[model samples]
Target: MDGLGNYLAPDHRRCDDYFSAAEAAALQGEWEAAEAQFNHFLAGMQHHFAKEETVLFPAFEQSTHLTGGPTEVMRMEHAQMRGLFQDMQQALASRDANAYAGAAETLLILMQQHNLKEEQMLYRMCDQMLVRESAELIARMNAIAQ
Candidate 1:
């Protein structure tokens, strides 16, 4: 079942919306608005990562007896992407458009690739190997953990 992945897709879409807006804002030279949008993107993506890392991924690992599975790669990517996001935030805060633009480009690429990987690979694998576990993971991830 793709239950968990389906549930999480909204989180990815929300991130997409923010980043897309950031890109548009940057193009229009709306620096402060772009920065604000990027900040919103950062917080949302971080929350999305937390739901996966702390709940969905761990639960899938537990249910399927898989350690250092696909989630490991995702977690690593999250850290790297987050580092870039932090750099972007700092540059934006300092009103350094040159730095912010470069970082923003990097973030766009990272989010696109990361979201693709999760939706196409990791989540699909989880759906196959942890079908029964999806419901349980979803409940815990969206509820008690919140």
Candidate 2:
């Protein structure tokens, strides 16, 4: 958790684990567990996105002075994922497993792609460019309201 990738990548996995648990519970017809797990997953995702959008991305943009670059793309992708989150939430509320499955599938794919870009490119750039500010940046990100 010392570097951007080190911290953020593990967060991604944590969210994914929650997602998997929710999906498994739904598949097993455990509605209560599914709802609980889905809530945890949703909260984890929103918090992660907030940390990046409010802290990491801003720091990267300011340090590099490249506002219309990776951060912009990531923001767009975040919006897209938020839409899927709504869809999944609606499906869960209605206990519609099929609809949830579809939305979850789309979200899973998007998350995989998004995480790859952040881990492989954006994080590496942040690590190199913001090495001096890494500690402060991570602290700010961690301080974001959950």
How well does candidate 2 score on lDDT at residue 93? 90
Candidate 2: which stretches are off by over 4 Å? none
| Best candidate according to TM-score | 2
Say which candidate scores most in lDDT: 2
Q: What are the per-residue Cα lDDT tens digits for candidate 1 across 1-146? A: 24877888888999889988876787677888897898788888877888888887887778778788777788889899889988887776777767877887887788789889988988877778777767878877776322
Candidate 1 global lDDT: 0.80
Candidate 2 lDDT over 1-146, as tens digits, reads 48988988988999999999999888787889999999999999999999999999999999989999989999999999999999988988999999988999999999999999999999999999999989998899888888
Clashes of 2: 0
Model 1 lDDT at residue 5: 73
- Give the count of colliding residue pairs in each prediction: 0, 0
Global lDDT of each model? Answer: 0.80, 0.93
